[model samples]
Target: MEEMECGIEKKAAAMAAAEEVGRKEEAAAGDVGLKELSRKLNDFAKARDWEQYHSPRNLLLAMIAEVGELSELFMWKGEVRKGLADWDEAEKEHLGEELADVLLYLVRLSDICGVDLGDAATRKIVKNAAKYPAPSKEGA
Candidate 1:
């Protein structure tokens, strides 16, 4: 009985660790601001002497390629809303990898161009909000 209890405890601990990993992966993409992400990407590229290959044009092309790859995952699949969970594990993993590639290239490009992506995104959001205000009850 004691051995069985120990086995169950081990299983519970393993399950908890798995859950934590899943949560971390779920929150991996959007949590970091562009400034921090760009700094990390810049350091990574510098460490590898990859800065030479990271000109804005090259980075932009790489980013566009990744975006195309990501889009291909949903190609001909009509109306992708709320159906991501229906995808197989390999499909989902590929999607995430392509997304990461796009983001890394974009950050590298922004760093090379000295663009403050976070501030630019914030300003664009404000501009968009002013251009498309919420509909009031009177409009309804």
Candidate 2:
């Protein structure tokens, strides 16, 4: 009985450690922001001499194309749930890639246009909240 208790305790400890590591990884991933992604995109373009081709119009067009690709993935899928519960790994990965492509182009476009995308987005969110306030509990 003592040995069984020790084995269970070891399993619980291992599970707890795994959960802690997963949390730490999630926190680290959350640290990556638009600025870092923008910088990486800029460096990638510069290294390949593609910066000249990344004009605002060109980036915008590329982003739109990526959006089309992303939309195509859901075109026939009739309303997917929030968690994409039915998506296979390959489908989800493809969706992620298309989304990332759109974001990268948008970040690059914003950089070329001298716009701080993060700050602009933050201000837009504030404006939207002010423009469209939530209903009060009293009203409900």
Candidate 3:
């Protein structure tokens, strides 16, 4: 029991340290963009030699799993408001973590697939705007 407690402590310490490093990096970069996140994830995988398991399919599946976890948080909540005004701090933090997981996996997958996610998203937004243009005041 003592050994398990020590192991858990060590794991917690390691995670905290990693978070500190991420915070420092984000501070240094001035703004945390997808490219920075992708680079950080790449370095993280390389450090653990886990890149072998980060194939596109594996990343996609993992991302889907994270999405499922995120969905579970709102499963029976029945259309939460945009601000989540009723949620407590802990619940919001938990939601943030799950959302981060989904985003990190997606960024990593895009990196592996040689996709410029920001550029793609911008182009997609333009395409969507063209497809569904806002009604003019004259029409309304």
On residues 98-117, what C-alpha lDDT tens digit does candidate 1 reach at each position?
88888888878887998888
The list of candidate 3 runs beyond 4 A from truth reads 1-30
lDDT tens digits by residue: candidate 2, 1-140: 99999999999999999999989867886587999988878899999999889888999999999999999999999999998999999999999889888888999899999999999999999999999998889966
Weakest 10 consecutive residues of candidate 2 by summed lDDT:
24-33
- 10 residues in a row with least lDDT, candidate 3: 23-32
Rank the models by TM-score, top first.
3, 2, 1
Model 1 quality (TM-score): 0.72
Give per-model TM-scores: 0.72, 0.77, 0.80
What lDDT tens digits, residue by residue, belong to model 3 across residues 1-140?
Answer: 99999999999999999999988876786577898899889999999999999999999999999999999989999989998998899999999999999999999999999999999999999999999998889966
Model 2 clash count equals 0
Task: Identify the candidate with maximal lDDT.
Answer: 3
Off by over 4 Å in 1: 1-31, 138-140
| Candidates 1 and 3, the one with greater lDDT | 3
On TM-score, who's better, 1 or 3?
Answer: 3
Q: What residue runs in model 2 are displaced by over 4 Å at the alpha carbon?
A: 1-30
